[model samples]
Every structure is written in C-alpha cells, then in structure tokens.
Target chain A: MIGRLNHVAIAVPDLQAAAAQYQTTLGATVGPPQDEPDHGVTVVFIELPNTKIELLYPLGDDSPIRGFLDKNPSGGIHHMCFEVDDIIAARDHMKTQGARVLGTGEPKIGAHGKPVLFLHPKDFNGCLIELEQI
Target chain B: MIGRLNHVAIAVPDLQAAAAQYQTTLGATVGPPQDEPDHGVTVVFIELPNTKIELLYPLGDDSPIRGFLDKNPSGGIHHMCFEVDDIIAARDHMKTQGARVLGTGEPKIGAHGKPVLFLHPKDFNGCLIELEQI
Candidate 1:
C-alpha cells in the first residue's frame, strides 16, 4: 500500500535556524517556508536527491507542533511520511486493520498539495506515520 | 553531501511484533532480524519502494535503544539516516560546521555494510541524524 518514502518531518523551535543549518552546513537546497494552517505548522522543505526533509515550527499557540516542542525543547523528529497510490484505499485498509487515523479520519491537503492522513503513533510503534497519495 | 534517505530507525520494545505489524497490516516486505553487537541493537528492515524502514530493539542491557525505550515505553522514531557519496568528506564538512559526530567521530560499518557516522541530535535540532556512505 505504501509507495515511496515521501518525506520525514522534524519539529523545530526555530524554523529559520534549522533551515539555515541544512542550507549552509549541509549545502542542501531548501524551499521557501510555507504556512500550513490546517496542520497548524509552518514548514520548509529541504530537497534531497531521493526524498525531502521537512522542517516544521508551530503556527500558533494551539499548534500541535508547539505541544511537541514543549515536550522536546530541542525539537525532534515529528513523523515519517510514505507515499501511497490511492489515499482512500490506503485509509480504508488502515482503518480495517484497526489503525487509528488522526483528526477527522479523512484525507487533508498536505504541504505538497497531496491528500494525506496521519496514523496514530501508538499503532505504528510510537512513530507517527503519514500516508500521502502521490 | 547527503545522497539519499537510507532509512528511518524506530526503537521498538518488541521487534517481532513491530516487524509483523508492518508485514501483515501494512503489507510490507520485512527482512529478517540481524544482531549488531557493536551498535548494541537487533534490527529488521522493512523494504519500501523508495526507502527502507528499520525497526530496532535493544540487544543488551547497555544498549542505547534500551535507554530510549525506557523514556518511551511504547517505541518511537529513533533516528533518520541519509546516504552520502563520500563519508569522509561528509564527516569533515559536518565537523568543520561544528556538528558533533557521535562515537569518537569515526565511521562504523552499519547494517547495510556501509560506512556510517551519527550526528548529535542537539546540533541538528534534536533529531539524531545518521550519514551513511552509499
């Protein structure tokens, strides 16, 4: 059901500093920071040859990233995303298998403008799994 | 400097159950578990179309993963590995940029039999980063 590894998301306290480290130190090509209101985070994509690295920061006080940052003051890996061919079918498959989907259990438009669903960390052995339809 | 995302490692309490979840529920092709005494972890790789997911469990009492699991009883994403064309160059660059390389700053043979070095999480926004020569 899962296709390619889409991107790995990292929650950061300072998005600019984190993006700058990747750009300057790692010599990586980073995209512009984008606000994802639905996901309640501002994200920047660091382009890689095979996959991308997403740097995320809280969009608001109530943002989930803010909560994550609160627990991990230094920031941390938030989630890992995998590509799926058919999001609806993937969601149904996950649901039938008893995996809890975050939010409304429906697909949401993600940073790549693709339909995405987040699987509960508990179900995936403490790692939040994001499935994106490519 | 990084070539591709090699894999994302998740520290799990039960390696067999975690591997089974990916194999049966997610319908992924999971490889057999292998012991890495040097790294002090037993790992299983779940092959995906684009990148692989590595499930890790403590190999001994002094295993780093054991400490991680103690903090997170359920399991969680431990580290993300990126491929580098020249590991020595990558290591030098990371060192020049003031990034702390873990374990005596030497490259060790990783699970894929590749030269690998780990960067401290504090330097990379709290996400443990591993660079492996492809």
Candidate 2:
C-alpha cells in the first residue's frame, strides 16, 4: 500500500525557469539539477515542508517526457510518486490484481537512488503512478 | 509556502469504479462520495497514510471535469492540492510574483470545508495547483 505522498512531478519545457518560479516566487528551497541518463531526463527537486515537487525536462529525444511534452506543448503534470514500505510486495500485489508495471516489470534505480516502478496510466485511471520504496 | 500535500485530484469517468479499484485492489480506505454543486463535480476521498487521493466525476454537463474526460476518456490526474499556512498571504505573494490565481483570485470553500484557491497551470509549469489554508 502507499505510504507517504513522496513527490508530484511536473514536466517543464524549461527546468531552470520552473525551478526559479518555485524558489523566488514560492520561497521554496530548490535543489541542483541532475541528469538522469537512465531515465533520459533532467530533474530538480523543490523542497517543501511536507513533500517535494520534481521538475523534469527531457534529456534526450528518447525521453518519455519528450513524448508527453510533444502531445502537450505547454507541459503538464507528469506523474505522482507515493512511498511504500515494501515495494516488491506492493508490485506483486498490484500485478496479481491485474496492474501493469512499466519497463521490465521490475524495480529500477530511480532519481532518488531507490528502487521504483511505474504503473501504467491505463490501469490507474489515466494518471501515471510511481511507487518507490522508502 | 506549501505545507503538507493535502491530496491529488484525479478526474475519473466512473467514480464508483475508480473508488473500487483503490479500495479493493490497492486496499486503501475509501470515503463516502459527496457532491459539490459549486464545482459541478462529485468527489470521493481515498485516505492514505500521509495524504489523500480525490476522485472526481462530472456532476453535470457544465462540470469542467467533463472536458478533461472527453479528451482523456480513461481519466487522469486533475490537479494537486498543497496545504498553505496562510491562504491570503500565499495568494498575495503569488500574485505579486506574477502567478495568476484561477477564478476570481480568491479562496473558495472547497470540498473539505477549507478555503482553497487554484493557480493557473501556465504559471506553474503546466501543473494545476490548488492551495488550501490548513
């Protein structure tokens, strides 16, 4: 089951501008941008009191975020992450119940250096859901 | 500044079916459905350990969610809600920084009986953000 609301991700055309908006306008602490080669995206974290906001920009043409942005030129909410105490159990449970996990259907090292799995949006009511082990 | 993440709203074509997925498959605690005529949507809350997930369905033809669902028949994330210590201060600060607050630029009573204001997605990296005074 889902634990904490880890972070909500937004795909942005300009990562720096998005980070600046959160830092200057919202007065939030923004972290350095990191390129996730495996995910093919560059990401920055905007720290909040209770959770974080992740700003993502496509790193390469193969980046899935690029496809999302191509469909929505203005960018949009990309996906939401929820923490889980045991991600393996959660994935197994979801799979047994007919949920489709993206990629190889196995956990992959995420931007946070934790094992994460992405659930298909079709199975999750059109919202892409990411599960990360804490 | 944003406090704790309140809830992530998802527009669903069928509220009951969506709630059932969370309840039966995900094993989340689902709340009773409530109709918000002011927003022209019916909503249900799925309680999580750290935050809640709101399922929204069109209450009438005028419901804004109708348009979203018409484009995404499968349903998807509508918006995200973050708790703010002072709604008015946050609104003023956001406005001063050139962030457009949706509607009349004033907080309205949301489904949780809290004063909430929506920010324009275009100003926030294409993510529709809702700030609630908590």
Candidate 3:
C-alpha cells in the first residue's frame, strides 16, 4: 500500500538556478545535494512546510534526467512520490496491476540513497508515480 | 506559510468509474460528492492517508475541467494543490513573479466550499498549480 507522499520531483536544466528561483518564490530552503550515478543525475531537495520538492538535473547526455529536461524544457513539476513500507512488495503489486517498472528490475537507491521504484506514467494516466521505501 | 496539500486534482471523463478503480487498487474511500457551479465541475475527493486525491469531471461544455480532459485524453495528471493560509496574498505574490492567474479575480468557493485560485500552468512550466485557502 502507498504511504504518505515523500516529495514531488522537478526536472531542471540548471539545478542551482532552479533552486534559487524556488527559494525566492516559495520561501523554502534546499537541502544538501546528492548524485545518483546510476540514474545519471544530481538532485537536491527543497524542504517545504508539509512536503519536500526535489530538483533534478542531468549529469550526462544519456541521463534519464536529460531526457526529462528535454521533454519539459521550462523545468516544471516532474513526478509525485509516495512513501511505501516495502518497495519490493509495492513494485510487485503495481506490476500485477499492469504497470511498467523503470530503473533496476529491483528497487534501487534514489536521490537520498533511499530505495525507490518508478511506475511508468503510461500506467497511471500520465502521472509518473514513484514509490520509495522509508 | 502553507497547510497540507488538500488534494491533487485529476480531470477524468468518468468520476464514478475512476473512483471505483482507485478503490479497487489503492484501498481508498472516496468522500461525498460536491459541485462547484462556478467552475462547472462536479468533483469527488478520494481521501488518502495524509493527502486527498480529487477526481474532476465536467458538467458543461465550457467547463475548465473539460479543457483539461480534452488536452489529456489518456486521462493524465492534472494539477497539484497546496492548502494555503491566505489565498489573496499567495495569488498576489505569484502574480508579482509574473504568473497568470485563472478563475475569478478573487478566491471563490470551490469544491467543498473552500476558497481556491489557480496559477497558470504556462507560468509554472506546464504544471498547473492550485492554491486552496483552508
């Protein structure tokens, strides 16, 4: 079952510039940055009052983040993540429901090194859903 | 600065069927139905732990929700909303940053009789953001 939302991820062309814009607009602070080499992206979390916002930027040409940036050049909202108790179970459950899983076949470490799995947006009516084990 | 995210609103063609599918998949309970005549949408909110998801269907051809549903026929994600302390201030602040505002000039009663305003998706990089004053 899905738990609470962990954060909403946004793909940006320039992480630092995007963070500065959000800080000025939303009155929030960005957390320390982390790099996920396997995903080929570096991300930072902006702690909001009730939910955190993640900013993602590509580290390489083939970066999945780069693809998202290319698709959404204006650098808007990316995906919404829900915290789950067990990622493996959630991934299986979603797959049973006919969802296409991205990333490793098994759950992999995400931006804060948390185990996470992504259900294809095509499965959820175009909304990219992320499940992360807390 | 902000209350919890009241709900993430998704524009769908069939609210009843969407609610049913979500219940079967997520084990959630959809709340009582409500209508916002001004916006021309009949909405049903599915209450989830820590957040609520709203399913919106249009009542009229000119319904703003209809526009969304038309643009996203595959029934994709619509908007993310955050509960705010002051809708007027938030709207003005966003406008100061050059965001175009939708809906009435002032916050008006929305689904469940709560005051709400929408920040243009164009301003936010294709992500429609709603602010509901709770």
Candidate 4:
C-alpha cells in the first residue's frame, strides 16, 4: 500500500525560472539543482511543509524528460511519486491488478537514491505514478 | 509564504472508477464523493500520510474540468494546492512579482470551505497552482 506522497515531479523547460517562481514568487524554500545522469535529468526541489515539488529538466541527450518537454513545451506535471513499504510487494500487487510498470518491472535507483518504479499513466487515469520504497 | 501542500487535484473521466482504483488497487483510504456545485466538481478525497489527493469529476454542464478532459480524455493532473497564512498578502506579492492570478484576482471559497485563489499556469511552468488560506 502507498504510505506517503513522496513528491510531485514537474518537467520544466526552464528549471531556474520554475525554481525562482517557487522561491521568490511563492516564497517557498527552493534547493539548488542536482543532476542525475542515470535518470537523465536535473532536479530542483521545492520543499513544503508536508511534501515536495521536484522541478525536472532534461540533462542528457536521451533524457527521459526531454521527450515530455517536447510535447509539453512550457512544462507539465510529469509524475507523482508515492512511498511504499515494500516495492517488491507493491510491484507484484500492481502486476496482479493488471497495472503496467514502466520499465523492466524492476525497481531502479531514483534521483533520491531510493528504489522506485513508475506505473503506466494509462492505468492511472492518465497520471504517471512512481512507487518509491522508503 | 506557502505552508502545507493542501492537496493535489487529478481530473478523472470516470469518478467512481478512479476512486475504486485508489481504494482497491492502491489500497488507499478514499472518502465518499462530495459534489461541489459552486466549483462544478464532484471530488473524492484520497487520504495519504502527509497530504491528500483529490479526484475531480465534472459535476455540471459548465464544469471547468470538462475542457481539460476534452483535451485529455483519460484525465490528468489538474492542479496542486498550497496553503498560505494570508491569502491577500500572497495575492499582492504574486501581483507585485508579475505573476498573473486567474479569474478576477479575488479569493473565492474553495471546495474545502477556505478562501482560495488560482494562479495562472503560464506563470508557473504550465502547472496550475491553487493557494488556500489556512
């Protein structure tokens, strides 16, 4: 079962502007950008009292968020991550429920250095979901 | 300054099906749907540990979500709500910073029975932001 709402990832064309908007305009605490080569993206975290908002920008040529930004030029909510106790169990449960896992159905090290798996957006009312083991 | 993340709103085509997906598939505690006539939305609250997820469905002929669902038939993330201590101050700050507010730039009673204002998605990297006074 999903425990906590980990973070909402937003793929942005301009990461700095997005981060600044939250920091100066919204007056939230925004962290510096961190590049994750494995994930092919750069992330800037906007910390809130309860949850976090991750501003994702394409890092490498094959960055996963690049294609997303291509379609959503301005930027858009890429995915919503939820924390789970056991990712293996969660993946298995999702499988039994006919929910499609994005990548090889295995958990990968996410940007936060945690095992995470993405569920198909089609199966979740067109909303991409990431299950992270915490 | 923004306080807690009030909730994340996801517009779904089929309200009951979305609720069932979260309740049974994800094993989340989902509340009964509440029809907000003023907002033209029927919302189902999916309670999480840190925050909540609101599943929105069109409730009236002039439902605002209808346009979004028309574009994204499968439904999608609608908006993210953040709580602020003073709505008026937040609005003035946003205006002074050149961030456009939606509607008449006035706080309206949101579904949660609190004063809420929606910020222009264009100013926030294509992500609709709702600020609620808490």
Candidate 5:
C-alpha cells in the first residue's frame, strides 16, 4: 500500500539544464546529482516541503529514459513513486492483485537512493508505478 | 514558483472501484468526491501524509483522459499537480519559456477545489502539467 508520495519523477533530455531552470524559476534548490549505472541514468532531486521532485536524464541513447524520450519527446510524466514500509510485502500484495513486477525479483537501490521496484504499466492501465522503501 | 505537490493525479477506468481498492488496501480514508464539468470528469481524493492521490474517471466517452486511455489504456500516471504561490506569475513564467497554455485565460477552480490550469505537453516534451494554487 502507498504510504506517501516519495517523489514525482520527470524525464528530461538534459538534467543539468532542467535543474537550473527549476532552481531559477521555482526558487527550489536541488540535491546533488547522483548516477545509477545499473539504470544508466543520473538524477537530481529538488526537495520540497512534502514531496520531492526528481529530474532524470538518460546517460546515453541506449538508456531507457532515452528511449522513452524518443517515443514521447516532450517527456511527459514519467512514474510516481510511493513510499512503502516494506518493499517485499508491497510487491507481494500488488502481485496478488494481478500486478506485474518489472524486474526478476526483489528491489535494488534505485536512482533516488532507495530500494525500489517498478510495476509494469500494463497492470495499472498504462501507468508505471514505483514502490520504494524509505 | 511551484509550492509543493498538491496531489498526484491518476487516471482510472473505474473511479469507485479504484477508490475502494485504495481505501481498503492502504487503510486511508476517502474525501468526498467531486466533479468538474469543465474537465468532464469526476475525482476522488485519498489523503496521505504530505500528498494526496487523486483518482480520476471520465464522466463520458468524450473526455481528454478518455482519449488518453484509448491510446494507453493501462491508465498510467496522469498529471502532476504542483501548488504554486501565484498562478498568474507561474503561468507567465512558463509562457515566457515558450510553454503553451491549454486553456484560454486564467485558471478556474479544478476538481480538487483549487485554481488550476494546464500547460500543454508540447513545451515539456509530452507531460501534461497542472498548476494549482493552494
């Protein structure tokens, strides 16, 4: 079950530019950018009062976000991550409810520095949902 | 400038079922549902710490979300609502940056009971962004 909105992930073509734009326009400072080699991407987090905004850009063309951008160039809303107390329990519950997990098994450290797993969009009517343990 | 995440909008085929499912699974109560004639849809809000989850369902077949669902039925994430301190200023800033406004004038009250306006996905690369004032 979703505990809270951990962060709203946005896919952008340029992470540094996006971060700077948000900072100048919204007056929101960003956290340090972090790279996740496994996901082949880098992320910068804009900390807000309640929820954080995550800006993502692919490291290369072969990256998933890059492909997503190619398909939907004006990268729309990417995925919504919900904080959960237990990733395993949440995955199992979603599975019982007929949701498909993206990876083989268990969540690994995600770009946001949390144990995260994705639910296939097919199960939730085309929305990719991320479950993270905070 | 963006305030904070007011809520994460999710498009679902069945609003009632989705609300019930969320309430039962997440142990979160539902706020009274509301409908916006302008948007041609009804919404149910599930409150959580810091952020709320909005379940949206079309009132009729000729709805924007409906068209979105037609293209991608798995009903992935919808729009992200960011509370802004001043809607007019924010809109102008986005416009100066070449973002297109979906609606003709200023923001009207949205389904979530706030002044909300949409920025066309074209500017942001394919993301329908909502700006709301709390």
Candidate 6:
C-alpha cells in the first residue's frame, strides 16, 4: 500500500528557467540538476516543507519525456510518485487488482536509488503513478 | 514565499471511479465529495502521509475543469497548491517578479476555506499553480 506522497514530477521545456522560477519567484530551495541517462532525464529538485517538486527535462534523443514535451510544448505534470514499504508485495497487489505494471513488470532502481515500479496510467484515473520503495 | 505543498489537484472525467481507484487500489483514505458551486467544482480528497491529493470533477455547466476535461477526456493533473504564510505578500512578490495572478489578482476562498490565488500557467513552466494561506 502507498504510504507517503514521494514527489510530483513536472516535465519542463526550459529546465534552468523552471529552476530559477522556483528559486527566485517561489522562494523555494532548489537542488542542482543531475542527469540520469538511464531514466533519460535531467532532474532538479525543488524542496518543499512536506514534499518535493521534481523538474524533469529530456536528456538524450531517446529520452522518455521528449514525447511529452513535443505534445505539451510548454510542459506539464508528468507523474506522481508514492512510497510503498514493500515494492514486490505492492506490485503483486496491483497486478491482482488488474493494474498493468509498465516496463518489464520488474522493479527498477529509480531516481533515488530505490526500487520503483510504474503503474499504467489508464488504471489510475489517467494519472501516471510511480511506486517507490522507502 | 511558498511553505508547504498543500495538495496536487487532478481533474478526472469520472468522480466516483477516481475516488474508488484511490480508495481501493491505492489504499488511500478518500473523503466524500464536496461540491463548491461558486468554484464550479466537486472535490474529493485522498489523504497521504505527507500531503493531500485532490480529485476534481466538474460540478455544473460552468465548471472550470470542464475545459480541461474536454482537452484530455481521460483526465490529468490540473494544478499544484502550495501554502504560504501571507497570501497578500506572496501575491505582491509574484507580481513584482512578472508572474501574472489569475482572475482579479485577489485571493479567493479556496475549497479548504483558505485564501488562495492562482498564477498563470505561462509563468510556471506551463503548470497551473495555486497559493493558499496556511
């Protein structure tokens, strides 16, 4: 079962501008961008009191967010992540409930170096959900 | 300045189905729908450990989310709400930084009964942002 709301990922058209807006305009503490070639994203974290806002930009040619950016142009919320205690159990439960696990149906090491699984958007109120083990 | 991420709002095509998905599938504690006629929205809250997830559905003929639902029939993230200690000060600061506040540039009573203001998506990486007084 989902525990805490981990983070909300927003795919942005301009990474530096988004970071600057959060820092200067919103007065939030933002972290430096870290490129995750495996995830195909260059991410910056805007730290909040209770949670984090992740600014994601496409990395390379095959970056997953490139398609999202092409469609949105101005960018938008890409996905929401929830923390689970046991990922395997959570994945199995989701499967039993007829929710499709994205990718190879296996948990992958996520952005935080934690085991994570993505559930199909269609099964989750059209919201892409990432289940991260915490 | 922004303090806490109050909630993430998701506009859904089917209110009951979305609430059921969060309650049964995600194992989250979902509250009953509360219709805000003035705001043209019916909302349900899913309580998370860190923050809340707000599921928004069109209330009547002039629902604000109706336009969003028309574009993405399957539904999607509508906006992100962050809490601030002083809403007027926050609004003034955002104005000084060239961020346009939606509507009359005044804080309206949000669904939570707190003073809140909406910022134009164009200034926020194309994401709608709501700032509420904590």
Q: Which structure among the candidates has the greatest DockQ?
A: 4
Interface RMSD of each: 1.1, 1.4, 2.5, 0.6, 2.4, 0.9
Candidate 1 residue B16 Cα shift, in angstroms, is 1.1
TM-score of each: 0.95, 0.94, 0.86, 0.99, 0.88, 0.98
Of 4 and 6, the candidate ahead on DockQ is: 4
Query: Which runs of model 5 end up more than 4 angstroms from their true locations?
Result: A60-62, B24-28, B31-33
Preferred candidate (lDDT higher): 1 or 6: 6
lDDT of 1 at A134: 87
Q: Which pairs, if any, clash in model 1?
A: B3-B83
State residue B35's C-alpha deviation in candidate 2, in Å: 2.0
Query: Whose lDDT is higher: candidate 1's or candidate 3's?
Result: 1
Per-residue CA lDDT of model 6 for B92-130, tens digit only, reads: 998999999999998889888999999999888789999
Best by TM-score: 4
Candidate 6 lDDT over A1-134, as tens digits, reads 78999999999999999999999999999999999999999999999989999999999999999998998899989999999999999899878878899999999999899999999988876789999999
Docking class of 3: acceptable
Give the per-residue lDDT of model 3 (tens digit) for A12-52: 76677667656665445767678877788888887765677
- What lDDT tens digits, residue by residue, belong to model 5 across residues B16-128? 76777676644466876688667788888888888888888887657778886676665767787778888998888877766688968588887767888997766654667
- Between candidates 3 and 5, the one scoring higher on TM-score is 5
Q: What value does DockQ give for candidate 6?
A: 0.82
Query: Model 2 fnat?
Result: 0.73
Where in model 6 is the C-alpha error above 4 Å?
none
Clashes of 5: 11
DockQ of 4: 0.89
Q: Write the per-residue lDDT of candidate 1 for residues B1-76, one digit (tens) a residue.
A: 6777888999998999998889877878899999988879999999998888999999977898888899998999
- DockQ of every predicted complex: 0.81, 0.73, 0.48, 0.89, 0.57, 0.82
Q: In model 4, how large is the Cα lDDT of residue B100?
A: 96
lDDT of 3: 0.74
Ranking by TM-score: 4, 6, 1, 2, 5, 3
Model with the higher DockQ, candidate 3 or 5: 5
